[model samples]
Target: MKSPALLGRITAVFRQSGAMDKGKGKVTGVIALTLGGLAVLAVLAFHFPQYLTTPDLRKKYDVAILREIMLVGMVIAGGMALANLIRLRNRWLNGTALALILLAAALGGHRVPVDDFPDNTPYVGLDWFILDLLGSSMIFILIEKLFPLHRDQPVFRPGWQTDFTHFIVNHLLVGLALLIVNFAIHRLFGWMVWPPLQKWVGGLPFFAELFLVILVADLVQYWTHRAYHEIPFLWRFHAVHHSAEYMDWMAGSRLHLFELLTTRVSILGVLYVLGFNQTTTDIYIVIVGFQAVFNHANVRVPIIFAKAPLKWLIVTPDFHHWHHSSEREAIDRNYAAHFAFIDYIFGTAVKSERRFPGKYGVLGDYMPPGFVRQQLFPFTWKG
Candidate 1:
């Protein structure tokens, strides 16, 4: 027979094991459910065209079905997150919140009549949904693991309130400003030079034209990005981006409206000069946008070949993180948007053996957060 002490110890071990087993079960269930919902979304996305074109379904089912699907998806994702939270892990809450917010936006905003719109873009369609949600999430997760601007910083650190405010303003307010700026520039330039430029460039093959367009746009971006660092006047607007103490998907979104306008206007000027066709421009926009976020992400890539020839061809997280580091050694290096070759050729590339940055955010330790203040900062703050 076991002694009383031994029996008590055995009971405690069993209890602890049971708790671990429960947590594991919850994790598995949450992952499975999330994946299952994604699968459903994919199916809906693919079949959306067929469903929309169907005379009976189109006549009977209104856009409300899309809203319903989105709402239900949000609830499912929230439940999965709640389940995971009950297991005592709060890390998954961000993913859950992302799902909820995106679904709500889609359901509410994607109600325009299909025929009346230029193209029949469906809200719940798999491509847009994946692009917005999964793509952004991947960028966020990658940035968190790679650059880790806030590796030593906790969530509620003194600067976090500012960081959070910057985040909300960038997403909610500044994004709209960028749209206005892009449209304005495009219209202004379109009136002056678009016709002649279009005739000249449209004669090239699609792939060739695309390559030229992207190259031109990236070249413009390279200079604009460099200017942001060198020119004190522009640095004020761009500082909102660099002020981040932590890097994530949303970190890339934390730019002031003025910064957004300046950057977009520069790129738009190039697009107008090049006269890229709509398809080429669309593809370029998608690739550039995704790469912009991905390069700044915290995702860790293996170091084996990442340091060799690969570093010369493409911008890796390892390379870009150095750009964000506060260390004197890393400042003012690796500014290329798409190709690492540009940075290498320009002598801005910095090679590292380590997988992640030692430190991140602005140099000199002086940074502020709030979106409104960041937008109006240079005018007001002495620093």
Candidate 2:
């Protein structure tokens, strides 16, 4: 009974607005709980690396470094929880955090050893999801706070649960998504690969190859994105993303699974056919990953991006936000993912007197809420 009550309190705290009550220790309590919870998950990941970790990521991770990180996280979480307990503030939250930390320590904490494990074990990308969530929150949240457009918008704004669920599901299924994309690419586009062209393209200077990669990929993305608006069936799949009324870093993750799979297959398929070097492709992935989150972030750039020419050359938050706008001037426009110029050249850039749209989301706001329902939306949607 006490455990259920504590859990309920934690959930209520999370569901509340992001504004912190430092005097009540609510801020520290939340941090303690978050870090302590992640520490427990980290321990499990360490204990069951074969089943919990990503194979590709495992190859690159240094166990020593990860161990040190885990140690620091546990120490901070424990310290915060203990401090709050001594102060007798937010006792339920801090108590729960301490309990999680103790449980993690009891289960071997960060000291859990990793021995030999079999290759190709079927696994969800739990490690990937955890690390990425931690990293993205630290980086993007800081940026949004420093250069905020919607100053009143809280970090845990309304609909954050939906977006966070999307992020978790998409990341956890990264293995499956890669598998599907690789299979489709090899089976369907293998013959399209011209060796001489691939060799030539791969041999280009690194920057040149990277530029070409972005250009080619963004072109495919532009057309695919436009189709999602111009075609009724495709719009249903895309509407799940546009249903996010609030713009933030995590909001970009609210994509329907079908759209995610098809879009990745289409863009990566073209890149595969082109046969760019692995290094260049890796760099492009990093760029795309950063921009995807950054452009959706509730951030405002004061000077450089205010210029029209630069906005046309690069996809900024201002530019991408317009694509998510419900206003008539912005509807079905600004489709390019990386290069804003792609939209301009295609005559799809938004024409507006206002600096930003007054409203966002689909014009009619027809889409349903929640993760499962949104995924099922594309299939069941009548309009």
Candidate 3:
């Protein structure tokens, strides 16, 4: 399709949602909407388990806590949805909510079996996608509502569907991303590994090892991020991420696939070469994963995190919000991911008088409007 047609279709999708007018469909509405959406995904996963689930995560449904959480979410969300269905008399919310209640009833919430073992199979993080979506939505979305840095910003902002699409693709395709990154690392950096160094690093205490890996990984990322800004060719690809004038949890996932693969491949190569123990690597993954979303989320930090020792220790929403700013002063500043000290040590850090950015996006508003155009954008775009 031509750019005009593509934009029209994407625009039409944005127009069809329940709430797009800078308002969160109320809390009960939020619960109903979320559970309803998850119920649909659950049904899809049940029928198409292989494509939806990862090879490693689903293992016999042995954990009682996991089951309990699912059951509780269903009960609470379903109960409220039902009450509101009768009380509000709104067909759409009530009907959707009623469907979820039925889904919870039919399939047995959290009791559905998902145990499969494949000797060699492709991975798609269906479980991860479901858990992360529910978890992040409840946590960050709630926080943003409670303490919004930009009060006017709504849960369903303009261009939100685009960011949500990016989130789904990135998470659901985690297996593909991992397979490619792992292959590139083993093939390209096999010689870089030293058994002696690997063993020595492994010997360190878990916390110490974790600390070292975070520093090293962020150092690698810091340079990669800087290069994206300073190098014109790379800038086009990175611009897909920066194009979001809105900043929220979903915004962090709005990355160009090329940039995502290259950055991950590079970092994985470095991590593998260093031979960080498996436990150390796994723990760091969780930390970085949470921080990536948290720092981008539209949250207001507590007094402690906003000031003193903690502020210097890690990246805050305010700190990262500046990097996405179109402000001339923040052109390439605040590149550190896990640690704020990296920025302070280097001259690249920007300390501004304002609490947050007044606006966001690429400097001249250069990015195309929709995902289709944005995906093809970097290749055909002219400076």
Top lDDT model: 2
Rank all candidate structures by their lDDT, best first, as comma-separated numbers.
2, 3, 1
Per-residue lDDT for 1-383 in model 2, tens only? 47788778878875665557558988888888988988998899999988888898888789889889988988999999999999999889899999999999999988898899986888888899889988999899999999998998988888888899999999999888888889988998888999998899989998899999999999999999999999999999999999999999999999999899999989998999888988898889989999999999999976578576787798888889999999888899999988889888889998876667778899999999899999999888887
Q: How do the predictions measure up, each by TM-score?
A: 0.65, 0.97, 0.88
Query: Candidate 1, TM-score vs. the true structure?
Result: 0.65
The alpha-carbon deviation from the true structure for residue 299 of candidate 3, after best TM-score superposition, in angstroms, is 1.4
State how far residue 346 of model 1 sits from its true place (Å). 2.1
Each prediction's RMSD over C-alphas, in Å, is 11.0, 1.3, 4.7
Instruction: For model 3, state the Cα shift of residue 59 in Å.
Output: 5.0
Give the per-residue Cα lDDT of candidate 1 at 279.
77
Off by over 4 Å in 3: 1-27, 43-48, 59-64, 107-109, 114-116, 303-311
| Model 2 weakest 10-residue run by lDDT | 13-22
User: Candidate 1 lDDT, tens digit per residue, 204-228?
Assistant: 8999998888778877888899999
lDDT of each: 0.61, 0.90, 0.80
